[model samples]
Target chain A: MNPRDEILNRLQQVQRDETLPPPWQSRRDFPELAARFRQALTAVKGEVHQVDSLAAAYDLTNQLLRQMAAEKVVVNDERPLPNLPRLPHITYHQVGQEDETLRAFCASADAGLTSADAALAETGTVILTSGPGKSRLASLLPPVHIALVPITALTTDLFTWAASFNRQLPANLNFISGPSKTADIEQTMAVGVHGPKRFIVILYA
Target chain B: MSNPSSATMSQFRHSATVAIADIQLQGALTGATNKFVNGRITALTELPHANALRDHFKKIRSATLANLAHYLELFEERATTAGSQIHWAQTGQDAVDIVLNIARQHGVKLVTKSKSMVTEEIHLNAALEANGITPVETDLGEWIIQLAGEPPSHIIGPAIHKTRHQVAELFSKEVGRPLPADDIDGLTAEARRLLRTQFLAAGLGISGGNLAIAETGTLVLVTNEGNGRLVTSAPPVHIAIIGIEKICPDWDAAATWLALLARSATGQPMSIYTTAITGPRRANDPDGPEEVHIILLDNGRSQLAGTPYEEILQCIRCGACLNVCPVYKKAGGHAYGSPYSGPIGAVVTPLLFGLEEYAALPQASTLCGACKDACPARIDLPRMLLQLRQDEVAARLLPWRERKAEEFAAFVLGREGRMNFFTKLGRWGQRPFQHDDGLKLPVNVGDGRTLPSLAPKPFRQLWDEGAVE
Candidate 1:
């Protein structure tokens, strides 16, 4: 017999209790979502800047980039950052460029800026999906990642965030809670071993 | 390519004895397990309705396992529809062969791995090396152990048994120069530099899925380091080996699992990265594996269905049980002499492997019930241990001396008169061995453990004299 059939047949013989308990219902009401999200994100070494407007968010992004002394920046092409003031000295790698050297550019880039698809307030996680003009490596390879998330995108938790994706899901969905970190060495926490060392979220109203 | 020295179950007692004597191993285990235990407590305390969430997670796991075949078939159908080739392997060798054939067809020279315990259980690395394919472990801890040519000691922290100095030596050999032993940041930087090139160069990436979403045909991987992302995204070809039990019914179930997993394991609300791969990269996608293969491996798991021990399949490999287990704390992961260790290992290893081979494992536990309490799924590991002991007894797998002792004890306890007679005999017979209120046997016989001295007078005797009333 084929291994699949044999295995399925074996599992078929097992008795199953047909009655399953109801799925877990998460409480979605969080009046202090911004505060909660900041607290959770900060605990994992992620910085959250809640701006009153998109203009403030753009200003903060430029301010943060300057503070980190970042020179090369990679921005995802999904949403154009038209309002953000561009610095002449800073080199920018725009997404959707046909340059095959994009991988190397991302590896060498100092920071990656992208817009989050959704945010989980409970865990302070930002969800990113790969699609047309959104390079997974842009968010992954750079040393610093800055996500521009709107306040409306914030949900209670993973369940609520997942529920919003009732339509077509992307090929890949990344739920990133904090900067890349590892305690693999003697239980000592070290950040930025592989992914972005610094994760900055600009939450605009 | 051969199995590690500690792979055999016969070495369990010897390894455990050695592990107890090794102060470094003891300290490492104590530090790591304590951190994890404390973190889990803190994480759960901060969550609202954490206990209810765990209960819901348990229901999801139980329900999924009950209808495992249906979920697996659904996952296969959805995955195939998403342009992924599905392969079924009933045994470890079969899985190894399937992977090797894929590698051969693609002419893959270097394979990057991202910390899959299932791969360790299947001994895939050894098989790959035997076929002349260099399998590089990209996870920092796994890489450390790989360089040292040793089996992983802990589930999450594979090289937790090794100290910084030992790691420095192993890494120095790899780099052909002496590296700083105490500098953790420097070490991580060096590892990142070395593994980055390998990630870019490797032809194929093999990872283990944490949870397979049946509804969407997605494989979820949770990792703090970006190695998981690189392994699944960087390489041209990607293969995920998953056990049959890891399937979740739908997105809701997957959400519940993701909610509990990282919190239970490392006390993080979520890991740094939770990557969900639906399938191979589409035409519009810029980067990801072009080809994706998922190997559904049974390897003794199918036989566990409908059995009393089926709940063991609900394990998410969170390693919480190891943190709380008294036996695992002392004996360490190496002592279990399997890919898995600690309480979960003691039960599952014997069930998946053979009872006679892992006879010593079930006996390793103290039946303290800490494992069950720590488990996110709330698997009754102590109950399973008791059942395994009963199975051993019924199978007559115990030594003749032990069997005789049990039989004699049963015979004595079956009757009140015999019990009283033995109590009197034991009190009198233990006099010669009594010292300082404890029985002091020879070192070779007792192995440094002492039996508590009998009571000065029997309770029954005192009751007969009306003194107890």
Candidate 2:
């Protein structure tokens, strides 16, 4: 028998006294989903700001772009992101416009902007998917990452999120709680090791 | 057993003594483990129904393992449907050969890798290097150890044993520029600058999966450093080397298991990034790996099924047991001399490897049951350790002196008359080695252990005199 057959055969020979585990139910109740989300996000050194409207969020993005002295940013060619006004000084490129340029931009880009599919309140996590316009690297490969989330996207936790998760999923889905960090060096917490250092979530109605 | 393994018991004793004596290593080990233990407590206690979740998760792991082959077949079908090619390796050599063949076919010269204990166990980097491929470990801790020409000391924090001054020196050598010892942020920046190019330029990327979900045929990769994302996405071709036992039946089981994993390991509600990769990049997808290969490695894992050691297969590599282990805290990770360390390592290593060679590891623990308490899956590590020790003794791995001593102890302890005689004998014999609290005997029970001196009067004598009323 080949390796697969042999391995599977060995495992199959074992007598199983198995009981199916109970299905997970969401008993976690967050009184204020958005407030708890902000607190959890902020605790991990991520920034969260609540804006009244999408237009105000765009305005805040512009202000943040200027404040951070960002010269170039990469954004997913998706809704809300495409609505951001074009600024002359700060060049914004749609991720995956050109494969070569996308890689280069991710290498040199100062910030990445995309809209999260869902946000979990308990851990302050954002769910991002990989699809036609949503490049996996858009939220990765930058010093700073800015996410646009709506108030309605907030869920209780991962268990709650998975309970209602769509059966037809994307090629990739990421549950990111905070900025990329590491405590590898002498157990010292160092932020922004690989991905974005500063994760800013702009929540709008 | 190899020549190196012949002296396993003595080697463990020697290395443990050295590790305990090294003040710097002792400080790093205790400091890191205490922080992890404290964080795990805080994270688990804060969550609602945390204990219930753990119990449910344990059932999930057990059920999944009981039907592992079935779930693996299911995962293969779904992953294949999602555009991933699944390969099974019966041994570490088979896994390494398959990976080399993939790298060869791709003509891959530079390979970027996320930190993976499975890869470490198989010695993938050595194979890649021998085949003229440069493998770069992207995780900071893994990279530090890779640069230092040492194996990972800890499974989670590979470089936890290294001090900042030591890391700075390694960084300085790598970059050919002196970096400040105290500035960790600056060092991290240098690593980013260094590894970013590797991720972009590398032709192939290799990673280890935390779990292979049979529900969607998804591979779950969890990391706090975001290296998993880059490794899987940056390179054109991706390969994930997962152990056969690392599986969850479906999304529901996976979700519950994950809830406990992060808390048990890092005390975070979630790691920075928890990615579920179904397949290679879709046709319209903007950016992801074009080809994804999943290698399911058995390598002695399947043999443990239905055996006394089957519970060890449920380990998630969370390193929780290491944090709370008293032996691990003092001896540190390097003393174990394997990919795994601490309480879990003692059982898993010997079971995966041979008990005769790693017999000493089973004796490394104090059988304090801290590991079982800290375990997310609630694996009975202490019970398994005792089993392995029994197997070792059965195989006559114990030295003649030790075996004879044990036999003599059994003879005396089994009979009341003999026990009384031996208690008096021990009391008289222990006088020279006796200290304030216990006996300071020259003999080592495994490592760094002390025996409490015998009582002034045996229980039999005290009872007869009515002193124990």
Candidate 3:
């Protein structure tokens, strides 16, 4: 017999008597969504800044980039603010324009600025998906990741998100909670191992 | 009904001895396991329904396993619809052959990999090397061990046993330069610089599946480091070798599983990256692998279904049992001589591989029940361990000396007269080895545990002499 048939036959004959687990619902609630998101994100060494408006968020992004002395930034030109006003101090290389140049640019770029599709207030997770102009590298390759999150996109948790998720999921959807980190060497915390060293979230109400 | 041993018992005891005697290893294990154990406790306490979540996770795993065939078929159908090519492997070699053939077809010269215990279990890297494909491990712990030519020492943190000095030394040798041991960030930065090239140059990427959500035909991978993202996104072709039992019926089950996994493993609300791959990159998307493949590996996993050991299939590979296990804290991961270690490894290695070959594994535990408590799935490992010991006896896998001692003790402890006589005999025989308050056996026995000598006077003797209160 073929391997699949043999394995299936073996497993089919031996299944025990058990019922499926009862359906679950998320009892978790966030009366203060942005505050909870900030607390949770900041606990993992991720930066969280709440803004009163999108204009304020944009201003903070420019100030933060200028402070870092960032020379180049790869911005994902999709959703929330597809037309982020480029500043003189930072050279913006928008994604999906001649895609081959992305890897090298992201490798050399000082940071990647993007907007999330949704945010999880319970765990302070930002959900990003790949589509027309949202390149995966925009949130990945650079040394720093700056997310512009709108409070209207916030959800309670994964359970709450899954309950109403009806659209087809993209090939790549990432739930990122913090910056890259590892404690492999003698249990010492070392951030910025591979992906972004600094994860800054600008939450706009 | 007898199955003979392929791996001798002496090998098990010897490695355990070496691990116990190495002060460096002892210190590392204590530090790493203690922190993980304490962190898990603190993290779980923050949850309003931590216990309820664990129980629900247990139910989900149990229900999934009991209906493994149904869930697997559903997963295969959905994943196929999503454009993932699913391959079935009845054995480890079969899995390796599938991967090698794929590599050969793509003319892959180099492969970048995220941390996958399944690949380590099958020794996939060695096979890849023999086939002339250089595989680079991108996870920092995995990379350190790969560079040093050592297997992973822990399930979550593979190189926890190695000091920073050792890692610095390994990094220096690899780069042909000296590096300061005190600067961990420098070492990590150097590793990142070196591996970044591998990600861009590699022809293929491989990872293990944490959850194969049958609901949406998704593969969920959780990783603290961003290597998982690079492995899945950077390469043109990607392959995931997943154990057959890693399937969840739907997103609800998968969500609950995720809720308990990172907390139990590394005490995080969630890992840094939890990437869900539905299929190959859409034509409109600018990034991600062009081709996606899933290999469902069943190397002795299906055989445990419906048996007393079926609960072992419920393991999530979180390594919580290891952190809370006293024996694992002492012997470390190397002593098990398997990719898995600690209490979970103790029960799992023997059952999956061969009962006789790994007969000594079941004996490695203290049957403390802490493993069951610590397990996210609440698998009763001690119960399975007892059953394994019984299976060992039935198969007569124990050595002649051990069997004789057990048989003799059974005979003596079975009756009042025999028990009384042996009690006296043991007290007389204890003199030679008796020192202070403990009995020092002639042979090198357990790992630094003391066996107290028998009491000076028997209670029955005192009662007969009217000296008891």
Prediction 1 global C-alpha lDDT: 0.88
What DockQ, between 0 and 1, does each candidate earn? 0.71, 0.82, 0.78
Model 3's DockQ score? 0.78
iRMS, all models: 1.4, 1.2, 1.3
lDDT of 1 by residue, B1-469 (tens): 2233232344677777788889988999999999999999998888788888888888888888888889999999998888889999999999999999999999999999999999999899989999999999999999998998888878888988888899889889889999998999888888998998888899999999999898988889999998999899888899999998999888877888998899899999899899999888888787778899999999999898888989999999999999999989988887777889999999998898888888888888899999999899999999999999899999887877789989998999999999988888999988888998588865444466788888978888789989895
lDDT of each: 0.88, 0.90, 0.89
Chain B TM-score of candidate 3 stands at 0.94
- Model 2: CA > 4 A from native: A15-17, B1-7, B424-456
Q: Give the alpha carbon lDDT tens digit for every residue of A88-112 in model 3.
A: 7677788878788888888899999
DockQ of 2: 0.82
Stretches of candidate 1 off by over 4 Å are A80-85, B1-10, B428-445, B449-453
Candidate 1 residue B390 C-alpha distance from true site, Å: 1.5
lDDT of 2: 0.90
Tell me the TM-score of each prediction against the true structure.
0.96, 0.96, 0.95
lDDT of 2 by residue, B70-184 (tens): 9999999999999999999999999999999999999999999999999988889989999999999999999998989888878889989899999999999999999999999
Model 3: per-residue Cα lDDT at residue B461: 89
